[model samples]
Target chain A: MESSEAGLRPPRHRVSPRARAYWAVRASAGWLMPVAAQVIWLAADTARLGPHVAGLVLTAVVAAAHVTVMPQWRYRVHRWEATPEAVYTQSGWFNQERRIAPVSRIQTVDSERGPLEQVFRLANVTVTTASAAGPLKIHGLDRDTAQRLVDELTEGTSADRSDAT
Target chain B: MTERTEWRRLSGRMLVIHPIQELLRAWPVLIGLVFAGTAGGQSSWWSLGGAIAVIAAGMLRWFTTTYRVSAEQVQVRRGLLRRRLLTVPRDRIRTVDVTANLLHRSLGLAKVEVGTGRTDRKDDAVKLDALHVDEATRLRAELLHRTPARRETAREETATPSEVLLAAVPAAWVRYGPFTLTGLVTVGVIAGVAGRAVNEAHLDPGRLGPVSTLLERWEHAGLPAEIAALVAVLVVAVAIASTLGYVLAFYGFRLTRNTLGTLHVTRGLITTRSITIEERRLHGVEISEPLLLRAVRGARCLAITTGLRVGRGAERGGSLLLPPAPRAEAVRVGALVLGPTTPLTAPLTGHGRRAARRRYTRAVGLAALVVAALLVLSWTAGSPAWIWRLSLVLLPVAAFLAWDRARSLGHALIEATLVSRRGTLVRRRSALACEGVIGWNLRRSFFQRRAGLATLVATTAAGRQRIDVQDVPLGEALRLADEALPGLLTPFLDSADS
Candidate 1:
């Protein structure tokens, strides 16, 4: 929510609950090639240790872990906050990184909703700076929330030219 | 101002100098030609004729090339068939470097190169080869002179002609040379050349009977002893080569603060170079202490300035303010280069104990991975067990280094300058002006989050874009980002909510 308090820090908000489903879909899409290879290996009878059985077990374990465990853990760690001054994001599951892009330093703010995300009414926001450390990405936010954040950040950046000094 | 319209030709002596430069550049080709002639059973006169033809073409080019300086721009017009006219705006000119190789020096001529800060292009610099030394210097001064408006403001400062800041003597070479890898590099270069020459000459090892016999005699001393003797010889050779190379490169190294608020560095034994850099363009100074150099308290200082990009095949020594000097002297030079107000000796605020723990874990993890890889290799590739054993022994050393590296990591915001120090093997201490910083980046890994740590980075336009303050608490990173650029982060601070 937009707060009237000028100096008050913004509260960290988690991404949309549909983020888990989005992540699951993305992970499964990525595993397509590996799943296909495992299937071929089992069908070809090239496996040594009851190969089909082992491959099926491994695939199930990985699919289950990605669909059930990873997305939830990722959702818990993902947090972002935007005020008039700067945008802060805490992201990543394995190497949780916190990134801050001051409104004045932001070069661009982009919000995108993919076909899958649109189906779930989810969007992603990317705040880019001239920094080599790369852009700050806030993933799986509600579509409207992502739009508002982009508008606020872009407006803040446009209003402040003094930071260039 | 009226004199600027005149188009000028390089000194007539360029006919001689240009041809020599061309010949030098094509020497490898000429060498290859001679070998080809020998192989083809052709006359030596054929090679000589080819070399002469190349030199004549170079001389013709010298005669055709011409340049002019206009009020607002400098223009170079050359090429007979495909005439190229390159015009550079006067205001965009960043540096004027005058270089003279042995032949040019002997002929009292110098090659003037004007850089415009567009380092990405190889032909970004406009070069006037074989100009009279005095003419080159005058041209350099005329081109680099500040505009009248800025001159009026700097009048008080320009009252002094030029002040000598630091000068390198013969003793400096000895003091700094061995600590650098210059010797090892020289050895490698020499080996490469010698190997190539031997291959080209089709030399036979068996023909050197005495040398082979001497090697055979040494082989009886046992492999370990023989290896020790070889290493000892290599070290001695490398030491001699490094010192010689250092002396040759920086025989008369001198740094001067000129009247135009610019730094003038002139150095070299044979070729000699004069590099001029405007003081305003300087972003900061980087003091680097390599692992070996750190042991002897020696360090090098480089100007982290815009426009002076360290380009490949270009003279990178332009940014070098101080070569190998004692750490104290290097820091003093760094302060002097930055201006009298900046003190490099001030205490730095270090990241707390969590930083050390993180570093230790990272180091141990890395060592463990290496050990694991070696173990796997020993099992699969049937490698020796001793390799893994040696890696296991290095774990403690790795831990110690990590702790040292963590201790070295520090950041301090003093006035308008932010000083950050990092590294263990090659420690670098950089002082960047707060105003120069364009953005801030805060990063945290899962392990870092568990330890309540974050890495903060400040991005600038000059030198390395990102300077990091690693493993500080997340809260501190937020505060630092705010403090470094006031009002930039304050509007976003969710202090009450957090």
Candidate 2:
């Protein structure tokens, strides 16, 4: 109610310790896919080039690079702000591209948590606008922070649909 | 008020007959196969008997199937051996489209197509067949949000009279000129022959060789006379094809809006189709006059409806709100159908306008090159030579470009609404509301930049779809966006940025 009176943006950035635990759980959970694929292929033909060690290593390396690089990328990207009139997202590596869509234009907003993220109490927020272009998704947020942001944006935009469903 | 309306579920016996319906639907394929088999001398008496049995089984299945409806919902259980039941919730239905073929009209039956926007995929919309005319109307009325009405016995026998808001008999002043069905057929024949000749060059290289070899072997062969005969044939073919094409394109084009406010268009011959557009899904209505249509004081109008039927051809995608009507009549019809749209002002002159002219010239140049290529190919091949006639096609393109520029020439920005009309031949006008617009994008491609023109795309909440007006003056586009944005969100644009 207070946030509504202030017209959004009452909460400052809250560091999420739960968000980090979520990343670790997600990284390990994803290992299941490659493990399953390898088991299926190995059972089919025992002598067929054995297990693809190179592919496993490459995937791990890329994933590790992503995990290590994401925080620095996140730090560079400034905080998001959802006002009564618009939802502003400022993101970039260097040049800084700022996207501001009118709050009314925000058709849908989804907050989802994978099994690992659920374990670590982290959630991903996606803001969808009416066009073919992809939604604006921000991951690696603390559970409470994610919830609050969702509540704030949802209330601020006066969206007809609710996240309770 | 007197009619006591009621509905009952379609009979279970009907589903038992479904296999027959499936077989009947495949009758075209079966008939084609039979003709092909008989032509190849493969038909036996047993085969003939088998075909007759299959057709008889299908007819038996169709005759037994029937349905009843109620005020609340429509339930259909149809099939012969295996009955399948389908229950449709009346409230979920978005639009009910009615289609009547000659067979249906004579039989007093109509097909009802119900669109439920609940599906993520639009094509999965439900279509029910062979509803008795009264049943179809009752279903359509029920689908719409309205008070339930009791149907009387007398009302059941009479066909529902649909309210008509717009009508245009094809104008007398409009001449087909070279754009006719006959002309199309003639051109098609010549082109088909030429294409076959060219194909033969690749398919059978030995068929056509040096002229000297032909002359030496066949001294009686009048090569020049043969060539002249081909030319004469091509000229006649093109003329006839053009006439035929024009007739087919403009035949029985009627667009009507029902009192319920749904737009319906019925057109085409041989395989006719009817498309109904729900009022809520419509973005706006556009009225346009192409240079050719303009000369006859006629204009074409279209409605920007959601869920465009892709790969369905021109008639299927957007709602043709009006067949070519007199310019004044088109405006009036558009106003009635679309709810009073703003009129387009005459185009203004400046750097951007000059650039638009240059862009049109570029289009003309590209078409001229294509025409020239076709002419040269015809001359090289033993096909009919008609290069001069081909050059005349470029004239229309030039005229079309100038006229399109003249029409799309201005943009009107009224408070919270923006209306833009653009086109030379097939004109499109789009009216987008400020509240519905999700975002505004100003884009300038290399071509646009060179032409001092820019395009403004207004994205709306209905979809990521945009209303794009190309080759408009850059300053005007920006000014209109600025003005429109303020009305939608108040001074919130600045506060949101802050």
* DockQ top scorer: 1
Query: Candidate 1's residue-wise lDDT over A15-128, tens digit each?
Result: 999898999888888888788888877777754648677778888788878777889889988889887666778788877666666667777789998999998899999987
Give the residue spans of candidate 1 off by over 4 A.
A1-49, A52-93, A96-165, B2-19, B26-36, B41-92, B114-118, B121-131, B148-160, B166-173, B310-315, B340-342, B379-381, B496-498
Give the DockQ (C-alpha) for candidate 1.
0.31
Off by over 4 Å in 2: A1-81, A88-102, A110-165, B1-94, B116-123, B145-164, B170-282, B288-298, B306-318, B344-409, B423-425, B433-438, B442-454, B461-464, B471-478, B485-498
Superposed by TM-score, candidate 1 places the C-alpha of residue B308 at a distance from the truth, in angstroms, of 2.6
What does DockQ give for each predicted structure?
Answer: 0.31, 0.12
| Candidate 2 lDDT, B333-399, residue by residue in tens | 7676666444433232232545557656766777777777777777777446666475667868676
Q: What is the lDDT of residue B29 in candidate 2?
A: 45
When summed lDDT is taken over every stretch of 10 residues in candidate 1 chain B, the lowest stretch is B489-498
Predicted complex 1: CAPRI docking category: acceptable
The total of clashing pairs for model 2 equals 49
Shift in Å, residue A91, candidate 1: 6.1
With candidate 2 superimposed using the best TM-score fit, by how many Å does residue B56's alpha carbon deviate from the native? 9.8
lDDT of 1: 0.78
Candidate 2 lDDT over A24-54, as tens digits, reads 5555567668766866675676675534655
lDDT of 1 by residue, B364-417 (tens): 889888999999999999999888988898799898889889989888877677
